[model samples]
Target chain A: MKKLLAAVLIAIFSISALTSCGQGLSRFSVTYTDVFDTVTVITAYAKSEAVFNKAANAAHDELLRLHKLYDIYNEYDGITNLATLNRLCGESAQPVGKDIEILIKSGLEYAALTDGKLNIAAGNLTCLWHDCIANGTGLPTDEALIKAKEHISYKSVKLENGTLSFDDPKIKLDVGATAKGYAAERAAAVLEENGISDYLINAGGNVVSKGKKPDGEWKIGIQDPAKQTGEYRFIVAVKDKSVVTSGSYERFFEYGGKRYSHIIDLEKLYPSDRYVSVTVLCGSSADGDALSTALFCMSVSDGKALLKQKNAEALWIYENGEYEKTDGFKIYE
Target chain B: MNKKTIADIILVCSVVLIAAVMLIVTTVNKKNGDKFEISVGGRVYGTYSLSEDRTVDVDGLCVVRVKDGAVYMESSTCKGGDCVKHKPISKSGESIICLPNSVVIRVLGETDADAVI
Candidate 1:
């Protein structure tokens, strides 16, 4: 009887382990590593392998499509399309795609929210910086920056009858700041529509996660700004949330033992020295990404208040290794 | 109650345990295989592969390369090798940055690949 009972117990344990298998989750990822940049898409599902492959393929295609549309190197992209059409026709409206329309609307909204700190019509400023950096020169002179600022007005870029056009020929549009977020959002929508409940999509620094991990919640780590390698500053438990981080450390130039990051201050036409990094959590990846950039350029108090107003959350890492969290963030201890 | 019966029971239990463990291990590896890494700038900012070579350019920042089972910041416009200090990233979910350049390097996990809108 004793032997029989042991056998029964073992059998039950084995069956339970099999039944509660958490490892059955299927995952897929595609990496596009190129000379200019790299983008990777990862998907986890309990559905068919074919379905996951199709979803990943679709997401990859969409990413490439957006890259073509927004890449500054491609002068024939949507921005140029609008610029040329506006110059030749003088505000004779041209029909735009839903995605572009949404982006323009969101861009205007963020510009208003940041009081013009997040202007998409600052293409002249972007071009000036690009030109200066390419020529191995520092930021343009104050007079030159002011001249460039003349074309950096979001209000001048008008939208009507499902069309977008710029009033000034000097005015240009660069969606580099927002295109990745929109692409990420679109990829997530594609996965969710295909019945992928458990997945995470990260385009550059913009990340969005949905559904629940088999263990119930997802674990995300915030990078340590001071650490060169092998340590995280914090770990946050997230679920169905999008996390986007913007930091000055990611890109910069050095001069006379000083580091100058690539994030330009539109007002100064120079790199900023505000917060080191800003992480935003919100419902949409695009919002999180855009807000992270905008908030990083603002004061800590102002950033927190902005997150509060948006009903979102943020964590700001300062230069001195100090950090601040918004009221909305339920940071893990 | 003899030695043969006891030995038979032990052998059967061992077989069952091994089979169960193997099933679990296979499933876990399958789930993990879906994850990949994207290295950017001179540092590995977000989640990405440490085993393969990857090159990325972050606009105003310098171009970064990850190759030959190591990660390093090859070049940057930043004053110091702040990004180079990050070395090469081998672990997932690790990152390096050149703050002055606005360049971010990250190592994302497999589950991190899902798109968030």
Candidate 2:
């Protein structure tokens, strides 16, 4: 009985000691639903737990605000979100916030950047597939796909004096690809401006990391697309950089005895099977997030070329279980 | 007593009383389990309240239970079954790991820090 008592005491002391070691950093985090239909976690660092909580709440509020603004599905009163903007397509000039303008302008530029590989103009086509995916109605017909593709082209969107219009009447804008990344970048900046440099903002798969922990650099794990739950392919050490991953396997539906991924290809006008997943490390999460999808849909040679243009490092897991990476791609334990 | 002696006596009494009270409160609080978080691989699955006391099935491979304010890996289909061998967790930051299954259960409060790498 005495020995058992002593063991219990030892265990209690060890647990306390273990906790003290991690307590040095004073980390605060909040996880919420949606910025993009997945879980979003925001972690902030401060000298004390009290300070960390304040900053964390502020960060969460900021992200929630951004989530609502960029949302294409739902509408909130007094808020002009992407859904509303898209509804006004080719109609009277719709006024938008500065952030929306930034998203739209860059989205058009990104189309040019990837030589049209990353097409936001695929908006109307996406809506058609989106309805099918949501309702489990299976793939859209080839005729519908071909028609929807007509309204999709970066050049189809026209912006004049901060006003936006689409040349094609059927053109509908879906910023789903780049919106989260853009919001992540802007949210990180807001946290920085508020003087909290040590933070990590993960909006769905788009991550914008700023600063480091009190002990050392922040370590982030890359999720293995093939594995289910809690399985990570590897870890990456990052500070003041965003690491974003886009995996076609993340969301998929089976129809006609075959699976169709949500990540559609511009040229194929169907779910791309070029890569199981793509991870890109870059200065901006928006660029990295968009580029990861763009790269995933391209040939290895083309993906590598675009990664160079973005000055980003990437790792591509091919459909056949092959891995392709840029020369500068780095991973840590 | 003189003024200095009186002050010292009050200080000593207060410290002892506070320490004793804290020890009792903590011991009693341990009977009720706290909120704990579950994760698979590198992502958070959910945070559950231990006070509710219920069994949760983790996608069919494993079953987790929160009972009597404590959480534990009741069973798992993993070959090793090592996670099931682990003890129940009830305090902030305490964790149980099932390496074979890649499931981790941790008791957390406020969640002010970043999660596992």
**lDDT tens digits, residue span A194-263, model 2:** 6678888877678888888754677676766665433466777888888888887666777888877888
Per-prediction fnat values? Answer: 0.06, 0.04
Q: Please, what are the lDDT tens digits per residue for candidate 1 over residues A219-261?
A: 5657678865335577677788888877776555555677766
* True lDDT of residue A266, candidate 1: 83
Local accuracy of candidate 1 as per-residue lDDT tens digits, B7-107? 46855885678597777656644432322333342223455455667776645467667787556677888875657756676444444545455455555
What DockQ values do the models have?
A: 0.12, 0.06
After TM-score superposition, the amount by which residue B82's alpha carbon in candidate 2 deviates from its true location, in angstroms, is: 25
Q: How does chain B score by TM in each prediction? A: 0.49, 0.64
lDDT string for model 2 (B1-117, tens) is 454554454455555655665575465345333688887743578889988989989877689998888888898998756578767777564567665565768687522223322
TM-score of each: 0.72, 0.72
